[model samples]
Target: MNDNAATGEKINQQARAWYVRLGSEQAGADDWHDFTVWLEADPKHIDAYDRVELALLDISPQETKSGVLNNPVGKPEENPSDKIIVLQEKRRLLKPIPRSYLAGIAATFIAALALLFSANIFQSPANIQHYATNIGEYENIVLSDGTRINLNTNTKLSVQMGKKIRAVTLYSGEAYFDIAQDTKRGFIVNVKDTIITDIGTAFSVNFYESTLSVSVAHGIVDMQSPVQKVRLTKGQKAVRLSGAKTMTIASVEIDNISTWRDGVLVFENAPLSSIVPELNRYFKTSIVLMDEQTAALTFSGVLNISDQDKMINSIEALLPVRVMDDGRQILLSGKQ
Candidate 1:
């Protein structure tokens, strides 16, 4: 109401914009450094930053929408920076949010907002958001455009919700896409060295430790990389290996690999080495074999995806092995 309050509000708004921009991968090193310097330069900067941070601390991320945050003008334009490129790199390192925790995030956020306003120390910013998931969690989210995404654990993604060109970057981990049919706008998911273009289809991309895998369930996906480019149909999967010139394509038993989406773990002749990643992914457990011989053995079985114990039990049953849980790690060894 007063000029000072109004001025503070304006500065707060600008600070919020900077925070959201920083969330973008397009935000350059110089820009981020400058922004950080500027923030630390003034008291208003700290106040504004704290306000925005408090607002988003509990708010979970939503699915990416087409033209969601690029611009509100509803027009096609060039990407001014390497945001997409940075996003691709981030996606390769992130995973999805868990369903159990996401259910409470909204309520927690609303409460936090109310408390912030009651204190009246800082005004919350609505447009900017920062989302993250811990280990062993996953979530399905709906974006503004009605597009849906199933986020995996230990993932960080930021969405710049706008009227045109909705954009999202996977900061880490894996995800499954059931992109909303937006033929006019199209939905795109970026990973390191590859871009996934879709229109109303179900697909899963796993980017971990520099390895990227893309699997299509229903409909089609155009996977483009610097080395290889191809269109994938249902029941198809492609993996991009580090420093490899060619991407490996295989006709996969879809149900076995993708059953995680349905809470089922189906292993159709999948090797022990191949299953390690999936086990590490589903449970917040670290499994290391003491001997290379144990690592080389193959596994074949179907375990309930939702139950980590059952899956591990199945693993122990099939192999002569010893399992140890140290709370921080799970080690498997050959006993028989």
Candidate 2:
């Protein structure tokens, strides 16, 4: 064979291998990512994969049902002549093919085409979608699988659904997920180094500067980091600081935890230091504590997030703090 023909044959073999591997149950996110990279590396890879799929379909049902396709390649008893006869009878082959090529074809034919079809690995752009919300804005999204997601201000996330799994990656901010239970395809959410796996659950995940918090309102979810793993159930919340080896799990009020979903911030004795950061996510004007004593003050109330001025006024009225707005930012100081 010429150099060009030899290279073509090598690519064809690789395409067949990828088809078999992807159809197996062991295929994962990394496998799919690698396959996509390979497919896009050269246009000929697409054509080669298509030929392998067509070749598999051309095989006779009687031969496939008889378990001839399941036999491993390079078996001494397996006859390449038998497959060539079937291909020739089906009018798919115009000339004689090599025995080694026939062996590769037989091995690839063992995988069901249905799995490949469901995967839709080639149309990656369509399979993966991104959603985001601007500051002071909230958006609701319902996925095809009936999963509902409520995105808080300045939040960004991506959803990628595969044949065996539904994955969401939260880039920043907060989101509440009402997952649709699928026993065969598990739901997972990824935030930085943390992984949250849903088990028929409704939960909220918040990813701020140096903290990651997961609060479960219903059902259960498993949260895992590099060094720790914990299962959270209804009314439970897990908080982990950046680079921490362990997470702090505590019981919480689900209603109070999810009040942000209703366009309100509910705080029960939450410190001014923590409240300022939450408010900063919604408004363009940054909130700054003028002193440590001011930051230590606690407030307990529900404040409407829609109006920034009203929220600031409510905080000033409810707590012993003075708010000073210099047009660019708001400064909070303990009352004299």
For model 1, give the RMSD to the true fold: 22.1
Clashing pairs in 2: none
TM-score of each: 0.58, 0.63
Regions of candidate 2 where Cα sits further than 4 Å from its true position = 1-125
- The candidate that achieves the highest TM-score relative to the unseen native structure: 2
Question: Could you tell me how far off, in angstroms, the CA of residue 44 lies in candidate 2 after the best superposition?
Answer: 80
Please give the lDDT score at residue 289 for candidate 2. 82
Question: Which window of ten consecutive residues has the lowest lDDT sum in model 2?
Answer: 78-87
Residue 333 shift from truth in candidate 1, angstroms: 1.6
